[model samples]
Target: MQLTKGVEQAICIIVLLSTQDNHNPLASDTISEHLQVSPSYLKKIMRKLVVQNIIRSVPGNNGGFSLAKSPEQITLLEVVESMEGEISIYPDTGLINKVFRDGVHTSKGEAVLHDVFNGANSLLRDYLAKQTAADLLKRTMEQSEIPVLNWNITNPSNQNKKE
Candidate 1:
C-alpha cells in the first residue's frame, strides 16, 4: 500500500534531527525550506510526530523541534505509524461476497484472502520495525556527501536567538 507524503516528510525530519550535532531543535520554517515542503503541511506532519512522542517541540526564540528519543530507539515503523496511523495495508471490504454469486462459499474465500493479506501485512510491519532512524541516517551519510551544517551556526538569523 502507498503511504502518504507526510510519512516521507516525517522520515526525513527524523533523519535530519538525528544528524544534528547535539540533536538540536530545528525550526519548522527551516525544515520546510530544506525539505521543499510547505510550512503549513510540514507543521501538520510535525504535530503528528510530536503526539507520538517520536519528536518533541521546543518553545521560545531559539526553539523548534527535536527528537524525543534517540535515533536508535525510533523505528521506521514508529514514524510511519505516527504519520499514517496503524499499518493495515488490507482491509476486507466485503466486496468478495458481492463478486461471487456463490454466497455460501464466499466466507471461506474471504477467509483465505484475509489470511494471505494479513500475513503480508505482518511481514511489512516486521521489516519496518526492524529498521530504525539511525539506520536510515547511517545509510544516508554513507551513500552521499552530506555537508554537516549546524543550524545554529549556519543560519545567521538564528545565531542571535541562541545567544
Candidate 2:
C-alpha cells in the first residue's frame, strides 16, 4: 500500500502550502523548481488536485494555486484519494495461498478472508482519515527542528551557493 509518486508529491505540496501564510498561491514553475520535478508533469498533478477541490487554480498574471480549505480541514487520505482513487486493502487469494507454506487457498468466498480484508481496509481508512494536513505540517516542523519557512529547502541556486 505505497503511495504513488504523484500522490507523494501532492502531499509534499500540501505540506508546503500548509506552511505558507495567508494561503498564498504559488505558480507551477515555482513549485516544480522547489520540488525538482518536471513542470509539465507537475501541471498534470496540479490539475488533478484542482479538480478534486483540494486546491484551487487561479488564472491571470497575479494568479496561481492555493489551498481550497485550511490545512486543518484537509485530510491526508482525501489528498491521497484525490490522486490515487479510493484506498482498499484487497486480498489476492491465489497469491496468498501460493506464498503460504500450508498452501491453503482462501479464494472460494471464505468468511475469514473477507473479514481479514475488511478489517485491514477499515483500519487503514480510519488512520488516513484522521491524519490531516495540519498534523503532517506540524509533525514535519517538529521533527526537523526547523522553522516552517524552511520548507522551501528546494531553493535551488541557494543550496549550491551554500557549498
Highest-scoring model, TM-score:
1
**Which portions of model 2 miss their true places by more than 4 Å?**
91-111, 143-163
Per-residue lDDT of candidate 1, residues 31-76 (tens digit)? 8887889999999999999999998999998789988988889998
RMSD of each: 4.7, 5.8
Worst 10-residue lDDT window for candidate 2 reads: 154-163
Which prediction has the highest lDDT against the true structure? 1
Error of 2 at 163 (Å): 26
Model 2: residue 144 alpha-carbon error in angstroms: 14
lDDT of 2 by residue, 1-163 (tens): 6778998899878865666543456777888888889999998898898898888887788567888888888897788888888877674545555545453444443556778888988888789899988777668555432123433345533432211
True lDDT of residue 36, candidate 2 = 85
